[model samples]
Target: MDTEMYIEKDIYVECLNDIGMLEIENDEFFMSPYIRGQRVIHKVLPMHIMQTIFYYTLTLGEFNCNEESVLKTWDSRNEDRFSLEMVCKRWCSIIKASCRSLVLSLNNLEANTFRITHFTYLKKLEIINNVNNDSDYSDYDTSDDEDTKDYSNNDLYYDYFDQRKNITYRRRKRVPNKNSDKLARCLSTTIQLSLPNLSTLNLSMSNLKERHIETIKSALASNKNIKKINLDGCPIGDQGVVFLSEILESNNTIRQLDLQSCGSINGLEYLGRAISNNNTLEKLIWSYNQSNYTSVICLSNGLRNNHSQIKSLILRACDIEGWGALSLSDTLAINKSLRELDLGSNQLGDAGAIALASKINSHPSLSILDLSSNLISTEGIDKILLSIQSNKTLTNLNLSRNQLDLSIPLENLTSSLELNKNLISLNLSECDLQNFHFKQISIALQSNKKLKKLNLSKNNFTIIEPFITIIQSNKNLKSIYISKHKFKSNELFILLNHIFKLNDSIKLDNGEVVNIDIPSIVHQLEYIDLSQSHDPLTKNIILLLREFRKVNNITKIKI
Candidate 1:
């Protein structure tokens, strides 16, 4: 028999042997027939009958079904379909044509073993090179060969010293594996040839260097199907950004580009120039660049001049200070196409907050804003709140980790919370809010019916009445996070009873009458997190909440 037919017969025999229906003795095969749950076959089957069984067994189920249904079934199992593809040539063709998205690990790619060209229908491809672990060294063993040993100080070698055996074994130092780079080169050669339907390409953490960029730059020039490219955590730096900026300047089909932590701070000026010239790019995430304010000014200038369709911009941890924020606010003043802006984790003090607040009211398309950990005090926050009074498009606002103190009367802050009808979610966690601040927020929540989510965790406050009143009145509120609060048992019992309405009244250990009939009209609160409250009475409250959750069909409660 030929090699193909012999391999096919061996696979079928192995499958039958797995279920104990066939056994091999010497060079012949024996069949075991099940008669009344007992194996009784004592003779060998004919070669023609065995061939007939092998052909029928492999062609069963979806294997022989319609091509469309097979494609749909295999599309959901793309990662595991490689094993099934190796069964036969026909099976391989069916599977490879059906795969839509594939995640290939660079560590497993062998030379000329796997081909990206096989997946003809692929639309999204993610190639990743993960950090090396002990599994990568499973095949490596200690060897005393002098030719393979290197004495470089930076290299690591193992020396196994046995006391009882009185023997020392020296392991050969492991050289860094370059298979991923080789596979990346192999992919770069043929990536542009077959991937016509490819749209999203993620090469994050793939250790891409200058050589890989040269090949990728050539491939991306002609590949018009790609729209989103993620190069996060790849040490491509300035040279790689030059190639991408060239692509962005000419390519109009690409929409979103993620260069987070790619060490491309110096090349951001090239990106800013590209942003000025390009018109189709919508979202750009270039976060985690330290002290890149000069490059940010160039980017802001590009945005201020160009009428591009860019929407979401994230500059978290880019060390944007007051001047950078002021420059960005100037861009936001004219560029109405931007919607979501995240400027968290920088030293944007009161000056920066006041600058951005000046543009919030008149800006048309800006909606979501995150100003967390920016050192904004009451003066800046007061201006932001006053701006919200006239702002109609702003829906979500985050001002967490700021020095927020509302001890003195701030009428505009409370007035904005009550008057603003479009704002849906508010985050004021870890803002050093006291009793007076909580009371003011509670007073605002009484009138703000549009607000649905509130996060007030990690604040120093002992009052629970304001929170209970807010929960009782705000029927539109769906979720609340008030973790890290120290609550007494009686206070927690009253809160839980208000939600579940499990009790009318409870007598505390101090003989105080705690009424649970506070009449909470809001039963739509879907989630509540009261975790990290190390009170002794929390255990009973959790048990009661658990029983109430099962009955009321509540979504979640973290206690």
Candidate 2:
């Protein structure tokens, strides 16, 4: 024991000498009684110990001592808390006090006795468990009276396993040992009894039942400081949504609520009402999973009242039609807080497109609008472009996969409305435009200098002459997509030569620019997409790709 003690003392002295602690000139101050006492008792005194002691002593009398100490202690405690616990008992005490956030990822957690562990000062707790794992105990049958249960209950239990076998289980069970009512009870008890200072709660990958919602409501009733709640991909029905709506109506601190991919339109209606009344919410994301047109219309009508303060609205695959678009237009025209709106993969037609375009022309705050994968035609696009010409706030617009005819006159379409200066990104892919359409687009590109990305892929554009001119003139244009369109070898080479000269990136379908000077243009090219192109160009393309690999200045090359 004496020999071991001597060895430890020698190691400690050597370490202190290495840190220049032993060669101090202010020995009287450095080796004071307070420092000596700490060194004698503490086994692992971290580097920040002196700073911690100094801050505590200097700020002893100030009222801000509590805040200062909280910050200082948190920083100091985090440094030695994890590794220092292995050193000795005194370190464990300090670490336990500082380590307030408990994160238990159930997949990695060891299986042990299920007893409630006490966390005194824990403020944030995250428990992420797999729905398929044994942790999912929601389906467990624990009723004492077995005779009272019918055969239907047994059939339901078997159906759960059968559904799992078929991979058709819609709602994932989070806790299989406890039923909805019991799980709710457990959560309520855990929140009120175990975690008192819990401010942020995120419960994902779970089949949230009605009783579980009640439990969450009961838990949130006392947690007034809870500022953010995320229930992503949870199967909470209308009743559960009502429970959350009540909570949101009373709670003012919750600034963001994400109930994405939750329940049906009924639940969404409840959420929209909650948002309508709640003024504190800054962002509400409720992207739908199924494309239900009726539900989308109902939700759009629910948001018609101008009291909603939502800034970002994402309704992907919501089966929104002309009527739904009109309803949303009415809400968005007057709503001042909304800035980003995504209505992708809906069945919006010319009327819907016109309705939305009307809102875009008037709304001062809207900056980003995505209407991709809709049934918009040339008339719809013409209306939108007219709106774009007049609107100053809209900067980004996507209109991909909307079968627009190339025969429409571009100048006449946008002649009346003033060109938008704020427009930056525009997509017009799969518009079925011929070579003549590119000339009109070229003229439009000359007028609009703010455009950065222009996509004209899957069109019947045969000539590349006008596109070459547009690329040369537009300095702000960074990306151009012109795939699935025929181009002559000489025309392709000319286009590539111009793009290389201008240092502009271009994406083209598979084709070989025969007898072209490759070495001269290789340095200027940044990105090229030639995935679908066939024949002899494939070999030359591969060789070019290899040559550019050695250059350091080239940022990206996509093939």
Candidate 3:
């Protein structure tokens, strides 16, 4: 034992001398402790000991300060892990295995020299493409260079994968200009090369062209794990859509595809064909496109196909007029799988509303419908209410920003609301409703036990007494929006006071109610939006929120 200790001491001494720790001024490497210009404890740490220190004492591992605060520190902790990995290659390997998400900026693509394929555990990959650099990928730049050609066999266009390390290292070759197509193609190869766990690929606003789309399609063709692809705001026009259609036709793993504002009108037929051919895709958000009458008809034909299983379709701001809506309505009538349809910000007037009203009554599965910003007046509303009076499936209906206020009141709709049991949320904001309309609505909703959310904002109502009645009567009412009102502070206070004291009861010893504090009725009120109210009213609501937050589960009061 004595000989072993002597040998160990000699080895330690040799290591210290080798590392220059035995020098008089060794501040160049080792941070040796000193007192009055004299060194103390000039021992050298072995490599294993340094690794042990780095893994435990130096590494930012699981922060177990508290369970509740663990989630709050996740983002900061993740960023710190990336920075800490640069300390050594061992740390980089260890840290890369645990990283589950990565955001790579396209502007700094050339600067990313490190291999990201080491992140085998990554589930989400977001490529942040700047909108300002969209011109870099424009067709107008006719610079005939070698880089512009198809680089299927080129090493410079592809990132080499290190099979031993399970990493795809970016090449050192830097293009003279920002050729997004080349960069995008390289990224596609990288995506296909590694990241077996990647499920979501967000390439929104990437300005992807036809070739880029084709490369992406090839890369993701066999990747059955990917469930969602968001290519929103990318100008993948007709030909690009054709490539995407091919992908959709063969790929059964994808469930949601967002091609919003991708700039395609004629290619919608191809998208429609894909939609009909694909059996797995469920949700499609194709908003802000020039979907005129003929194009919409083409799209609608696909939607009504027996093979189409799309559940949610959003066509907001698609320039859809009466004829376009008529085509969609016809499709909606036959497509029983569709549950949510958003046709807001379109030119669908009363004719379109009437057309949809005729079909939605018989539709079996639709539950959420948005017809806001359409020029539908009382006649359309009357027809809709009449149609939905017996319909049992429709729950949420949005009719905001329309001309619902005419000289004649919607008496039929007001009366129909009292009998409709399926409707839960009704948004009538900016519908030009007056006190009489409010009175009728309040009276109508008195018997409604299922309606939970009600939005009556932007109508500029003078009297909120009708709404008070609503709060007093409905026990299931949870959220109410009554913003932009000409209501007094005291009136608002009374309404909120009633909401807070709702459903609570007190009884005398003999079972006789002494002072009834019952919700003027029973309720589980959660949200109230009184925004755009008087300043004093706003302040009072804030104070009220603070008070209610201390005891009740009232989540929010938007003022």
Candidate 4:
């Protein structure tokens, strides 16, 4: 044991000497606490950016904007736009020189910009209004435009998913606009002076009825760097649209324009003329103007000769009809750039459907086609389905609420889907489905793998619920809405509880085996609605989901 211990001590001394941990001076050993040439932990900052951020954090106070406090500051500054550089003078100077965005609207524009000259890095400037969104709405009676549906942060769970498609995805929110025309007109020149390096400008109108449209015309004409502009819920009248038409005719750098829910305007004819001729724009989203046939025809004429840069065109619920659809079809046959087109709830009938189908072979860029609520019959459905067999670009097709006969159209649909193979999502809710239809769809799904979503709501499922027992599994169903259907208790139990395997391997703290059948990781159903089903089945479904949520991270389960 002594010899072994002496050998171990000799090895430890050798290792320490090799690592420079044992200082050798005159044959006497001295142990160093820390190894030489080792890097010390960085105490203050490793990178230059960390030091700069730390300095700014210590200098600048928290950015809190209470209405009364901000208004008080605004009044105190006598409308001089308070320097957004709220840090120390050094940090403020750095940010003023480097900041790419400067937003000044309402009373915030009171700051004079004559003292500053070199704002070369500024890129995006937004000037809306000063109305307190949360407090003002509750106290004052607002219009429908102010009451715009806020679907922000909420999951996309709408039958009408495209309602907020255009501007909602822009990472910007709705700011209440004021009808104070005097304030708007006064701020027009201030808009020009502040936006020197601006690339995108958002001007949400205060009151659609009384918003100063002249300010928009002035701002659009004055800026050269503004490439994108969003005018959400702007109540643009005939005169306002005429001004926009003139500005769009001359503007070359502007690429994206969103005038969603701008129906308060009556002059779509002018806007259509401008849209036809503009070559710089890549995306145009215009909705709720309720234009008539003349305006629709004019818009079609504009798109026919458009340069291939235009990629997306969304015009939803614009009261377009058969003639309107026919005109747009003529343009689609030739237009090369348009990829996404939404014409839902336009009442485009058999003639419109035929015109659109004939052009799909010519235009391969057309991917998303929404013809829901267009009064299309079996003949129209057959025409559209036949187009898919020849064309390969189509992905999402919504033909919901068109009163299609499931018995007649189901055969053609499955065959076309088999041939197409690329279509991902299809909505066929309220189509008067049958038992045989469900059975055939199950058989079709056995072979097809690309088709994902199937919305079977408002179908005659009570009569046909038993037939879907053959549907053993669907791996890609992201969402399924089966509310208001009389599903049998056994059918519900089998479909939900029995399809998935539970983890019986789990045990209790008391060393007992806990075996309760609930959701495990083997389920793929992300969203399901069993609301208003048979009472006994609904109770079981609820109990199952209460435990299901505990186990799985399902997004939503509607009761």
Best by TM-score: 1
Per-model TM against the reference:
0.78, 0.66, 0.74, 0.67
| Alpha-carbon runs more than 4 Å astray in model 4 | 1-105, 112-124, 130-187, 194-197, 208-211, 215-219, 263-266, 306-308, 405-411, 463-474, 503-524, 531-543, 550-557
Per-residue C-alpha lDDT of model 4 across residues 1-559, encoded as one tens digit per residue:
1111121334555655686655455533342222111111122225455335533433343335332232211122332222223212333454455545555545554454332234455665556566555221233322356346454543422222247554332222333444345455655564466555667767664443224666657676666778887777766666767877788888877888877776544466786688776888887777666878888887777787745367788777888888888988888987888888888877798788878888875577888888888888777877887788777787888877777654455446666766777778877777666556656565666566677666767766754333233234455556667676666654555455433343434333345543434433233556776577754544545566677677766546675
Task: Quote model 3's TM-score.
Answer: 0.74
lDDT string, candidate 1, 170-288, tens digits: 65556656655565676666565667888888888576765567667766766778899888877777788888888888788888998878776676677888889889889898888
Query: Which pairs of residues collide in candidate 3?
Result: 502-519, 503-519
Best by lDDT: 1
Root-mean-square deviation per candidate? 8.8, 10.6, 12.3, 17.8
The predicted structure with the larger lDDT, 2 or 3, is 3
The lDDT, on a scale of 0 to 1, for candidate 3 is 0.72
lDDT of model 2 at position 285: 67
Least well predicted 10-residue stretch by lDDT in candidate 3:
33-42
TM-score for candidate 1, please give it.
0.78
lDDT at residue 406 of model 3 (Cα atoms): 75
Instruction: TM-score for candidate 4, please give it.
Output: 0.67
At residue 473, candidate 1 shows an lDDT of: 78
